[model samples]
Target: MRCPSRARRTRALLSALIVSVFAVFCGGEIASAQQEPSAPQPVSAVQLQSAIAKLGDLDYSARTNASRLVRRTPAAQAVPALIQAVSEHGDGYVRYRALVLLSGFNDPRAKDSMRESLTSPNDRLRAVAYSFFEHNPDRALIPQFVTAFDTEQGEFVRPAVARALAAAAAGDGVEVAAARQALIRDVARGEDFFRSSVIEALGDYKAAFALDAITSVAKLDGPLQDDAALALGKIGDKRALETLAAIQRTASRQTQPSIAAAICLLGVNCSSHESYLVETLKFTDRNAGYQELLRAAATGLGALGVAGHQEAAASLFDVGIPATEDSTRAPVALAVATIALRSTRLMMTLLEQYADREKAVALLAEGFDMLEEDLDKERFFAVARRTYWESDGASPRRVLMQTLIGTLDF
Candidate 1:
């Protein structure tokens, strides 16, 4: 399976081209030289072909370049080079990139090479291999795809395989039933990656049976419960609505947010529990914004198709309690506030809370300087209006601006 010297070098050359191109694009002002060091360099295609023949000069940077080209280009000629780089190269990440690129090629030769990598001794490589298979959902490869699907320990791979299987199952595939069963198995176990992937795939396939899987996970613990709750909302097979109602009743307060989020996201109008959402916030001692929790709740309430969902927002206290950890806090604050603001009642509550909490209050006041959207400006203003802005010192406003933004969107 190792690539030949010639092919290996081609991959390296491809890598060099990519780096050069990126440098040229990124540092255009700097690279705009009056002359090339006032002298012409001597590099020819024949020498490049020879230099590329050797893999010794290739490194991860080069491999990265090769992978990107494989994804974008129409050249079938690059397939063999990429296949060798992935199969015989250093590290599974590089191999994974190669597999992704290989999927684009229509030739059986490359497809066969990709299939062979499905059994890569390295689990990372196997994970990438399955991703390609899942993305394609080719029935002819299901048996081979399944081998990796079942035994692969990599959570990363499982989601993609489940997705591919779910995608493929609805078609005239040999393993349509098996794919359905696998979806059940993953959801039932509360496996985080598989559960979400299956639920999402069900959305793509419109698999009503998949709702059972979502319901099953709603019963499990940890992330799947969260995922299952979201999936149920996404699927919107009304048959599961009764199950959703049941789960809403018995599930922990921790689970409520997800359930609410799911209902909201699905746009289903079945939420008789609108009062319950209002009631739930009062009882729960959770002070900080629970993101997954709020998302599940707001999204589910949205799904309930109830106009009164404005109540859920009113219950949100408009003034968001930011998590001490800015990473976790900001996104949750924005999302829940956005969902809650859908209702004027909720928006009023949020505005009131902003007026109430002093430090958190000040943060919302200055949020607009950093925030671009009118929606964010509105959310922050709602918080600012609810909480009193007491200026403590010069840094009071500065402290607020610091949390309002991050180096990047989390």
Candidate 2:
């Protein structure tokens, strides 16, 4: 090519440099544009307020969605708003939802609102507040619960207050003596509505001093008496065991099973009670008056099973097979499942009794649900699959097998 003029050559070089710079800048911009955005932080106060209000939405799904959103918000910003919603909200369900959401936040900032709700004149609010304490117990709030239990007069409030007291007492840094005394006073003199809760609280606290008071209540004939006997049994004291034995002897047939359950729970020598429990299982009559006794006996057998008593499992299996009474089958099946967890081979033995494969599969499904540990669930699933097989693709047993396998995956 012919030599260009110096100015023209300089201009061409400048133009090339400009193009190169432009290409580099554009490439950087394109790369920046292609990158993913960071997750968005929680929305502002106004948006959170909107979400809180949506909690009261007439549509159930909308309210549930709002709850999920509120739960994800930063605890510092969300706790106060949630507490206010629980305290000042007009809709009962919305307030209840707020209380439920507040439970997820471990922040102590929500305590004041919880205390306010605990003392609220509204029974439902008080109940939710107590339930909140159950999930998020604060040792500092123990005295407040004790005071609430002392003064709260509403029947609905009493049970909640009792539960709150129990939760707070169980926590560290609580004055055990004061909590025990408060529970005992309520069990002895509080209204009948509070009695069952206070009795249970005593058992949780293992208040040995309250033994005499609990024993006195165990003497009377009512649901409260059964609760008292159970409480004494949980205390696991020698005196408590002796008192339960006395109640077993003196109580009518209707009440004896509960006493027997208490005795069994105490880990006493329950051979006599075991015989009684097994006898109760032999009766196949579902409509008979002895149904309550049968349930109580089955419950006792399950307790024994928990203690790893092999005979209890055998007895439960005996009752579960050929259990014509639909009402009794659930308890018997549950007991067998409970024992089967301890003795894996016992499950196969129990399954063998049910000639009806469907019923056997149903009981296996129930057992799967009752097992809390994942390892145990997997073990059970493996055993169940190997035991039952369907050569036919259309077999209904396949459905049960699939369901059992799904539990392990979940």
Best by lDDT: 2
lDDT of 1 by residue, 97-142 (tens): 4555554444466666656776677665565555555545578766
TM-score of each: 0.51, 0.57
Model 1 / residue 35 / CA error / Å: 20
Q: Model 1 — TM-score against the truth?
A: 0.51
Among all windows of 10 consecutive residues in model 1, the one with the lowest summed lDDT is: 31-40
Question: What is the C-alpha local distance difference test score of each model?
Answer: 0.47, 0.60
Per-candidate Cα RMSD to the true structure, in Å, reads 16.1, 24.2
Q: What is the lDDT of residue 268 in candidate 2?
A: 74
Q: What's each prediction's clash count?
A: 43, 0
